[model samples]
Target: MSADEGTTPSPLKPARPSMTAAMRSSSFLNDHQQYRPPSKPDNHYGIDTVVEDLQASSINSPKQISPFNGIPSPENPPTIVESGLSHEYTHPNCTQPPGLTTDRLIATLFYKSTSPRVSNAVGPSSSPPHTASSPVRASSPTGADAEIPSNLAPSSSFDTFPLEPPTNDTEPLDHIYGSYVSPMCITSFLHLMSTFPLPRGSTNLTSAHRCLKLDAASDHHPQVVELTLAPAPSQDYLSLADLRKHELIYRFEREWNIDVVLRSDTLWRRHPRLVVFDMDSTLITQEVIDLLAATIKDPPDLAARVADITHRAMSGELEFDGAFRARVKLLTGLSADIFNQLRPVLDVTNGVRPLLRALKKLGVKTAVLSGGFLPLTSWLAGELGIDYAHANEVVIDEATGRLTGEVKGRIVGKERKQELLLEIAQKEGIDLEQVVAVGDGANDLLMMESAGLGVAWNAKPMVQMEASARLNGESLLDLLYLFGFTDEEVAILSKET
Candidate 1:
């Protein structure tokens, strides 16, 4: 059989009308379609239109072609049925043309909708299915195949690709997956996902958990970590609450100390010379008059009078002279011998010895400017090796050997304290800058202000607010450092004392 002779006669099938044939046969085309020699093919089809037409033809063509088999009949032309009934079918191995796979279709649609160039780089695999053994299967109409579990099936391929889990072994205890399923898988997923570049460094569950942990541990939140020690311009100017918040734990010689802050270097470098101390509640723990009164007859009444005067004088409410005079008049005719009897009961302030001893060795002259009487001040000066003592002298009549209800010298009021400081400075050839004053009373304000450095020692509120420095938590020995004394210097001073 020759090729032409062996060919079967074409079947004489009934004509089925085509829209193109009908349109061409009409009056419109009869006039327009007169055969003219075709001009050079007009390049009128747009690039996009040509591409789409080529894609459509390719998609409709059979997968295999053979010359021995005549042109395929329309009924038998390789049928390209979608994997599922709907266009949204997903079944592995189902036949489809190139670029019609679910992934490609999704990507193309996404690129068209968003106008972004879709990159072809493969992203992380979806999280392993809950039942790892049951593999997923998906297929496009064009025969493209993909396997993804129903649970792992992507909502859309245009969605962000999944990330592998972290491999961190030290996972949080509260992790839901870590509590139940394979920890190994969770760890591996974390490690793989970490490599993916996420928008804000969080994509997978593990990274989200890590981010939360980091936020919890931040310094902005109140955790029990040591505070950052960066220097601020003004340490002394902080609010009371802020001062307490950043309080430092310090180790001095043989002592563990906690305080809001330490004085700056400049304060100690320019150390004061003459030190003035308030006698009661500052140098000594107890008011000597109150102790003396307790030892005297009608102790309760005398103690009450002494306390009243002390409170008023300390608060800056009553003039120091008026309060002192009133308290002294109550003690008038009380024996000068009472001080000797009550001297044993007097309690010196803590660390007073080391403080005074260190000051003396430093050639820092010390003074006790007290609202307390002269006799007590003189006695304390001798005991403590203080260089100067200015206090209210109780006038005692020689005939009676009892108080005469008068102060002999200038009253040790606040103004008088300031004056005495100036007078002592002049007498000793010392500048006011060479003076260190310590006090606990409002009456001490003038004296404190007069000295170069004023220390408020467990002071009243007014004094604490106004003083150059305040020492509340540590003993008087702590003042040694404030004077630029090192630990070794303190030890040496201790030995000398």
Candidate 2:
């Protein structure tokens, strides 16, 4: 080509020297020396070039980016700065990918970018380097809402493109509930998202209300981020079939201790009207029946026997009512005065008072359904200002003012708990789907199942697996986060007490 043809470009170089020859050389130029002529400047950029540049950087730099892309591949890896994001995660037991170089990883990230943004740039490496003035592509959906007319396209950053929110019909809204996802993990998450094409994110960071908008710096809890995930092209919705996306989700959870719950955009789910808690281990740390039996000093081993039965019932070993009734029989002659001693020392579970107070301030109805005696449950309801309280009534022999060794009313067993949940929801004029149940035992399973959301709080493994959600966190306040309240909102509500 002549100087007169300067406006046009020269023939491009071959894809590369063979992998064998390229692998033999350390620097990119060692094998592909002819591609960049010594006589000229060039701007030809491709995924392979991106790969080579990152590869060379990895080889020469002291720290490798690591296989999991700095999800802290080991117990405590250093913060990795790549592509303008600086975040580090320490997933102490997260499984790492097989050994892969940065080059291959970049290759994995862009292998799907077969569009003109990639193929059209394959001219001579002898052209001017990429610049702000160079014609660039915008990665947004092209349609009637296109900001730039097709005739006047301009260069834009990938960050300039906003990920579109999921429509009600196509992709449902969901949440990733974990304390681990930070701004830096955005890159890894984006990479995982890119593995399956996602709708673009927002360019309006200034005023944008992310699905979860938290001021992490000021928030005591890790900020909740609203995530909108969709099925990739040609893929069936995961609700109907197995989802490969969950693989990445579970991986992140395993490594970073995150729990991704796919919640709907419905109002009832995020802001339920009623929340029922089991009194024994859920609302309080101790089992009331076991405590009641412990006060029977005459039979030194009665508490031990009652506790064993209570444990078995909670673990689902024995029938709930049978075990409960047998335990009451052990409490046979204990004086009614025992209730006075247990009341003052009743230990509320950590985060219970604050959570109940917050819920009350928000006007969410709260209830305590217990298989234990009604007196303690009612006292708890009064103390916490809960709306409803239901429990078995201990039959006391009025003549002697001593225990009758039986319950007077209907047993508040698992089945009864379920019935009461629906009954209360109806009485409150709330929908059945607008109630939440929290418990820590097998008997609570049916009641939990009946509610829209069931949280197994520090429960047995079976309850954890079967419940709609589980809260193994240190406090119950995190539930408010799942409901989409921010730090300020939570603080304001939790202070009502």
What lDDT does candidate 2 reach at residue 181? 44
- Candidate 2 Cα outliers beyond 4 Å, as residue runs: 1-179, 182-226, 231-252
lDDT of 1 by residue, 52-129 (tens): 344443333345754565554535454445765434232222343466421100000000100111112233332322
After TM-score superposition, what is the CA distance of residue 374 in candidate 1 from its true location, in Å?
Answer: 1.0
Stretches > 4 Å off in candidate 1: 1-270
Best by TM-score: 2
Every model's TM-score: 0.48, 0.56
- On lDDT, the leading prediction is 2
lDDT by residue (17-47, candidate 2, tens digit) is: 4568545766756566776634221344455
User: How far in Å is the alpha carbon of 324 misplaced in model 2?
Assistant: 0.7
lDDT measured at residue 112 in model 2 versus the true structure, 0 to 100: 8
